[model samples]
Target chain A: MNILVCISHVPDTTAKINFTADGSALDPAGVQFVINPYDEFGLTKALHIKEAQGATITVLNVGGPETEPTLRKALAIGADQAVRINATPTDAITVAKSIKNHIQANAYDLIICGQESIDYNGQQVPAMLAALLDVPMVNACVGLTIDGSTATAKAEIDGGHATYTANLPMVIGGKKGLVEEKDLRIPNMRGIMTARTKPLSVEEGLSGSNTAAKAFRKPAAKSAVKMVAPDQVNELVRLLHEESKSI
Target chain B: MILVFVESWNNQFKKASFEAVSYARKWADMAGCSVKAVVSSGASNPESLAQYGADSIATLDLAATGPGMAGQLSTMMDGVQGVVVAGTAVGKTLAPTLAALIDGALSTNTTSTPSSVGPVVVERGAFSSKGIETIALSEGMPIVSFVPNAIGIEEKAGAGAIESGSASGTDKVAVSEVSVASGKVALPEAEVVVSAGRGLKGPENWGMIEELAEVLGAATACSKPVSDIGWRPHSEHVGQTGIQVNPNLYIAIGISGAIQHLAGVSASKTIVAINTDPEAPFFKAADYGIVGDAFDVVPRLIEELRAFKAAN
Candidate 1:
């Protein structure tokens, strides 16, 4: 079986978010970039499938050359090959379109991606790709298992989890329960060396919809926390009900 | 007409659906358009939406369509100017697909209502809720999925005529059964949330959390470690890799805030952290802090909440 895993380049979750001087774009000056944490979960799941089911894993990302290090990291984590769609991903729709075009050219039995990227948090690409490619998809899947050509996935909803079944050539938007953090593979010295020589290819992508961001601003700074002693817990309740009007 | 997808499960309108209705109603009033609703489920209560500004409700018998409601939504988006949906799991799937099908723009987890900022625009969290990004739809209709609790739900009586329909054909994928936590407030729609981390030590100590949540009418959540160890359901895990919530009030019990955890909840209107260690990172992000033991503090906190409720 052939598996495709899509990853995104995002600022570290702990990075300080800042807007440009004119407040039109994100200021990348002091931010440290890393593979989106959710995408890491998807990549780990793909590697697990590769190990257990003997599938070739190909990692894909639509980004500029700056995303190569993240792609190499996926290779080190055990992807068979890496393909970079040399395009500045504007929005989820365009990104999914590029992915759909790529997947149409090179077929895959399964496609995996995070529920949403940490940066934009649109949570749209997986669904859009599935719709564009006319394939079945499971959103926010927590547990996934592939038995031959049949795939059964467990996805948690508002109150309970839904069990879904679909054939191969499907898409899954994965969350935490799909793969545990402890199962993530770190690049060893040998794996890093091998990643340097791994097959990395770049391809042009389709220019699709342009969803633009007008401006960006940081969230309002949190005020100093109101300290309430353990015995004065009721005061906190009073504050919530009366002052904040939240209760 | 402004179209809003009323999200229902098991034929019941979820709280987020009402929120979506109220949100659309406000925007529609501004746009001088009627508010129309579409429900894919066998909605138990279609008339309830009428009081919340729905002029008409289109109920679709999507039982045969399975979980993929995008086709039905695409058909419903016809002749609609602005589309509003609750940013729940189902809406997240349908809105994007509809946006793509219409060659329009889509914005999820909107922190505020879409307004005309030289074009249709919506404010949504970016970079894991650390910042807010104002997105403009380049052209075509705008599909906006509002985050729960961001827009207040209000009542305004309107015509509420129900029209029934169904998807033309079946979908490729099929959901065998929908497993939802019965009788509990869903995390996404909850206005108040009380989340526990490993600080509580074990699942057996969850009684107070449940009691507090019950008294306050809030939802219960947990940290990644708590869920990974089977202490809580994975559905209740809130973090960057888990469910991101924007509740009005978020209380953390025994959970030292990790960056991943904070990423999911920083957009909350107010945060209260109760941890034994005052230096826990969650304090920096919280509006209130109580440095104490959960065993001693949680029960007392529950008692205080009960007393406050009784007084009110």
Candidate 2:
């Protein structure tokens, strides 16, 4: 089996979000970048698949040269190879098309990526990529098992979850439940040394975004808490009903 | 006309369906267009859409998978300039695929109505609610997913005429089974949410939390550690890595509030925190806070709420 994992470079969840002076783009200054936490689960699941069954895993990212570090981390964790599409992703549509272009040029049996990047949280690329390729795509996937040429996957819905079956050459958008947090791999010294020798390829990517961000505005700052004594349960209820009108 | 994709399960229209139809109506009025509500199949309360703004109802056997539905919707465009879908799990999966299939512009999880019609312009939450972004779409057909509970439900009284259409069933990614809890309130549409964390000690103490939720008509959620340790199901977990919830009021009990957890819920209109430690980080972001043990405070709060409900 050949699996391709799509990695996204995003700000750490704890980092403060700030935009440029023009309010048109994100300000990367002083922001720490990391592999989007969601994609880590998918990559770990791919490594497990490769370990159990004979398979080769290729980690892919669509960004400028800055994203190579994240792709190398995926390699250090246990991917066999890496590919970098040399383009800054402008929108979900542009990124999906770029990935589709790469997938057409190279064949892979299974594709994996996070449901959404933490920074944008659009949750668009995987489904859009599947549409562009005219293939099956499953998002919010928590459980997945492969049998021969078929893949059985479990995805979360509104009230519960649903199970689905799809053939190979499909895409999966995995999240935390795909693998236990404890099972995620860390780069050991030997693994990091080996990853430095692994193959890393770069290719020009397609451009043009359907939607363009015009401005960025910050949410209003939260006010200090209005504390009520622990014993004042009635007063709290009264405030919730009379003052806030929330109840 | 604006096409609104309304999703349904177990022969009932989901709460998100009403919100989408209502938003489509408002957008249609602003854009000077008519509204059509499209259902995949098996919606028992299709007429309720008329209470919102759907002028007509078009029922089709929409293929269950995103790719399949995108293919079906491509053929049904029929001079429609755009479509509006709820930002539910199903709608988010389908909107982008449909946009890609038809070579249209796409926007998901939009918080506001588009400021312009053709070459639509709108604002959406970005950076996990830390920032609001304005996006402009110049593509011919614009597809958008309106976030659940972001817009208020309105009544416009549509004609609600029903039209039937055939299905182009795509066999890819066939749904083998679906399991949904019967009466639980879904996190997305909940107006109020009651959440607990490891500070509650164990799952055995969840009865009080559930009681509080029941009295408030709220959904029950948990922090990451509570779910990780098997004290609560993963579905209830809300954090940067878990589900993001934007309820009108959020009540956090026994949670110390890590940055990741705050990212998922900071969008809430009001937040109340109950924790044993005064120095818990959640208090910094909450509108109201109480420094006390959950076991001591929750039962009393539940009793107060019940009495308050009786008098009202």
Q: Backbone clashes per model, in order? A: 7, 0
TM-score of 2: 0.98
Q: How accurately is candidate 2 docked according to DockQ? A: 0.83
Q: How does chain B score by TM in each prediction?
A: 0.92, 0.95
Q: How well is candidate 1 docked (DockQ)?
A: 0.76
Worst 10 residues of 1 chain A by lDDT: A205-214
Model 2: per-residue Cα lDDT over B247-310, one tens digit each: 8889999999998999889888889999999999999999899999999999999999999999
Any residue pairs clashing in model 1, and if so which?
Answer: A159-B180, A159-B181, A160-B179, A160-B180, A160-B181, A161-B179, B11-B44
State the lDDT at A28 in candidate 2: 91
Lowest lDDT sum, 10 consecutive residues, model 2 chain B, at B163-172
For residues A126-217, what per-residue lDDT tens digits would candidate 2 score against the true structure? 99888888788889999999998899999998879999999988999999899988889899998899999999999999888888888998
